[model samples]
Target: MPTLTSHLTSHPQTAEAYTRATQSAFLSLAGQGRLPRPVLSQWLSQDRLYAQAYVRFIGGLLARLRLPVAKAADAVEWRVLRVLKDALDGIVRELAFFEDTAARYGLDLAAGPGEASENSSAGFGPNRVTEAYVDLFDSFGARHGGAQAASVAGGERTLLEGLVLLWATEKVYLDAWTYAREQGAGREGGKTGEDLDGGALRREFIPNWTSEEFKGFVDEIQGCLDEYAAAQGGEGVQDRALELWKHVLQLEEGFWPHVNLQDVASTM
Candidate 1:
């Protein structure tokens, strides 16, 4: 079986897109300047809340697995879950910091915790493509016999699916963060006009593409992918993970174009 890097590196177009979206989202936050300060501040507040909920959900899934986070396999399948869990924890911490900052800047993002039923994070919104993607992950998770029921009898497939789910989430967070950043910096800049340091706003809320978190994501996930490929003794599972990763890459590549241009037109 080819190594995980071999499978992912072989699929240049998909990998490139994923990498690009990750960075572009960060840059977009830095460059965005289309909305009033108040609106952008509120958006940041709402986004942080969303992050909190997302991490909580991921935590629940990890808790169901009973897998020690420091497991021996840097296996792509296990790593996918571990990374997802790590991301959730990290995002939760980051959101708390962002909330305090947004509030200091006079943004009110206190939305009553809406039930996931009312505000599902399954997709960009209620649409055919997003709905399909959500269904795909749901099926993927249940495919291993509903989380707790399955054993290593089909662990490989479950891990690949989790990686796909990770891709989907990264794609969405990229979009949402881009939207929030653009809005935050859209205010006019001048004395009493909008004295906010837009760069500071971005730095506080958006993760730097070059930061350890982003770089580690590529390296670690790839490592996991490669490890899984080696253990499975085949390339089929690796290919599937790559395919799902592509779905997310494409989603992000096409995301900014769909961002509310009208909402942040001034900053664009």
Candidate 2:
């Protein structure tokens, strides 16, 4: 059975986008501990905002999944629901991780430019890329029936699309972080040498991201998406997944440039 993962990999453009994202300079420099503190602080702040939105995104998806499916009592549906529940729990832990990271790095959680504006798309301050990503997730949630909505509107198709987006986002994140970990390990053409002390990023952040537990969560997300995509087989499904895969890559690529410390400093 061809999973959505297989289908996505079949698309050359999708594969290329994923490759580019994994190999991006942001990840490379971040792993090497070469990014300035201000830049990393800015990036982490934006990510914390994104993480908050992601909790809502997963909540919305869980709400959609709870609606009665055509196969009401299917074990697969139950399994997916359990997976989503576990993922929500995991996000809670992830949020705590971000909070700890911020504290350790002395990053002000509320320091970003848009923090004062409650009207911003993201309730927290968000850079443009973060705002755009939040809007995309919000639109999907609104279209499919938001977290508090009593009835799901867009149905299975919407659920599938949301799942694709979730999977793609996690996939890119895992790959990018894994790439960073590898680079930090001195595997990428001697980027991090043995002589220098491995900085907090290499010793702390990379380990947190590349841990076995985190890898397991990433795998669980991938499996859930693959199972759902395989069950919802059709020509249109692959196309939709591919489209979402590319969109996620584009969003991720756009996010890195916003972390440029030099650019941020130049404006100030």
Candidate 3:
């Protein structure tokens, strides 16, 4: 049987969505250097907010971990905690990167949803999709589900679930940028990534997103997730993993500068 990640990527239900999330029209246009500046700004702005929520999401997972008393060699908790810490560090750096890139490119970090074109609707601050993403993050927090029963802890948004989420997001992101790096404006002729998309995308963003270090981080998280899944083997685990995988893929597919998600932005 395939690993969970491989299974999700290949499963008929998730395969198309995974492809859409990684090889989207938005990314394709970006690869071709034909993406409009305003469209890019809109996505960038929403992404900044998403990154902010990610910090809290990782923190929640860190807090929920119940490390064993003994400091066993290479304990799963230690590995999981380290990855979460790395996630925090990475996100902090990303926020700063966002600030620098936005200023350098004169792109508005607060660009409204659907602000891509004049005909598209515009709204202030975070869009519906962004808020929805945040909601999902908050749902995994230690305090989620209100009742706070010990039983509920493992029932709703367990540590395994949150870890899976973290892995899924990072996995999708790495693959998405890998796609960009291969065919983005950075390719072709003697063009360097810095030479295209005002240096924000092909150059800065794609390189950062597709870096070997980032790949290592993603791999570590995947190992951690798989380890936890195996250690926590039980009924409903696979079902929950599959459910969250599909959910994240769907959200990712919507997160792009997508026409199908225009209503999500407009309705907000």
Candidate 4:
């Protein structure tokens, strides 16, 4: 039986967008050791901001999972909760990596919305793409009572919806970096031909992203998502999952362009 992720990724439109995103020039340059330092710095800053929001998002998902269901004693919930807890821990480590990377690169860790911008030429503020992505996570967190209970004007989201979003986001991220790694390897003429042969962007960031441990983390999330979806099977459930899946791919596709084009006019 196909997992919900497989079903959604198999869709023609979704597949195309996903492919474009994984093969994006932003990632390609990073892999090839060609992405500018300013761009990488900008990305690190924006991603750090996103990671903070993600911690909140995961917290909300954990809260929802803790809610008593009919099968309150089932092992599935326990397993999923455990995975979310691990994810929370993983994000903390990831944030630490970001801070260390920023310090090593001389990138500003305080260049977000409220701070005086240092890399304005690289568009060092949160752009529309980051804003929209963060909003989606924040909205879901708010709806799920992770931090503060807020009214969702349209309607409340489901645990399944949140899980799908999480799965989609992580899956895309893993695949994108994997693609970058492969591309970088190919540019060197083979998978094991040579190291990235450049700076920290190649030596540290790419390997950290495409490492086996990171891949395992992504797989665990997918497994949790698939198990939940299988148990909660329904057309409506699948439909909603599919919608969120497509929406995430679309957002991811746009994300690369937004970050890469930060200094577009200056470059030209």
Candidate 5:
């Protein structure tokens, strides 16, 4: 199968829009840096629970599959496993970061019910937005249970959807972190007892977003999407997939508006 980069490269407009939107979110923080810190802090703090829930859901689905972990070799099953594994690994590490940041802010990172908890709503706040988002994820998971070995050789739309979810979620976190760093540095005017210079402090607050680690991750995701786009067998499938990406791009553009960050400029 082709790599994600190849698929997205074939649709330059879509790929450019995706990159541009992410860059706008990143640069907005770099420019303003005057938005409220609590808005971003709250978001960074809640990410752990969301990551855990998503991980738990995916793990459950994977466990129900019959194929061996690495046995699928050249099929869609193998690609799905690869994507899921990569996502879960990142989520686990991010959960740890959330815990540390929560402690720094004197907030409880463990606000959500544990993974073993039966009630899905245990850790969630009273916000209708999060409820809607979580319910959608739960529904999506339930509807698309697992990748079957009998499916096509290349990966399916479900796998591409997963990659898109991973990319979009991480981008959201990065945006919040950059926004927080900018606001913190702007208000404090320099270092604010954090032992980091203004630019360094910006990097420190948002690990995945600002670090080399997540940039590489994003590159992999884009590559996967590019591959998916190239593997389309029919006009209907290709158009549908492109449309799905367009929807994702629009959703991402709308995401930051809900975070309630003050002093942040309009999106690019």
Candidate 6:
């Protein structure tokens, strides 16, 4: 029998979206050393915003969790709490890393979609794709019957679905960067970290995303997700997870901008 997560990826449409998201032309550009500085800035800025929203997203999930009593280390609830805590910690560090890297590279932390000034760090606020991600994160917390959200059945989404979403996002991100790493392995000037846009991505960010520590973190989330799914057992739970997985794939496919029209992704 396929696991919940594996079943989520079994759908042909879901698999295609995952491929579009993970193997986008954007990653291809980063690997080939052809990506422009403005595109990188745009992506970084949107990522920063996404990371910011992730804080509240985790908060919602934490609220939904019912922690086990002290020393219940083996409980699925305990494992879920630990997974969430680790996610929170990782995002905090990731946000700081973005700040430091942006400052060092002089890339615009405030860059937005459009013919953005590659030299200017202040462009605009969050773009459409970033806001869409924020909205999804907020959906876990949104009140029932809200204009922008309808996910709430009783009050908020189930912990099983939330864990599924968490797992899906991290899994897609890890695979996407891993693909980029493979493509960018031996490009000219990559070692010097100055090939394109300060080579922050091809050199620094890509390796960081594909790092052992990050990979371990992704694995932990997957383990936690499966644990929670099994504990929640039932065909219904599996169905919910699969639906949420498809939603995440759609968002991710739209998250990474298209290759040639990098800036255009943000506006839409």
- lDDT on C-alpha atoms for all candidate structures: 0.49, 0.68, 0.75, 0.71, 0.48, 0.76
Q: Give the TM-score of candidate 3.
A: 0.86
| Estimated TM-score for each candidate | 0.55, 0.78, 0.86, 0.81, 0.59, 0.87
Candidate 5 residue-wise lDDT at 60: 47
The model with the greatest TM-score is 6
Itemize residue pairs with steric clashes in candidate 6: 108-121
Candidate 3: where are CA atoms >4 Å away? 115-122, 146-155, 185-187, 190-196, 259-268
lDDT of candidate 2 over 1-268, digit per residue (tens): 5677877867777767777777787677677667556556666777888888888787767767753557656546676787778878877988898788667666566654443322234434787778777866765663444432222222233667777777778778887888877765654455333212235467567787778887887787778788877776766777666766777887897776434445333321
Candidate 2: give the clashing pairs.
none
Cα distance off (Å), candidate 1, residue 127? 8.1
Candidate 5 C-alpha lDDT tens digits along 31-69: 334324444443343444456567755664455334446
**Candidate 2's TM-score:** 0.78
User: Please, what are the lDDT tens digits per residue for candidate 3 over residues 90-116?
Assistant: 999999999998888778888786644
Better of 2 and 6 by TM-score: 6
Q: Which residue window of length 10 is worst by lDDT in model 1? A: 111-120
Q: Comparing 1 and 6 by TM-score, which wins?
A: 6
Stretches of candidate 5 off by over 4 Å are 1-37, 60-79, 107-129, 142-157, 167-189, 192-203, 228-235, 257-268
Error of 3 at 13 (Å): 2.5
Ranking by lDDT: 6, 3, 4, 2, 1, 5
lDDT of 4 by residue, 99-218 (tens): 887676666655543222332334445666776677778767744433211322235766778888888888899899988877667456533223222355666777888889989988
Clashes of each: 8, 0, 0, 0, 9, 1
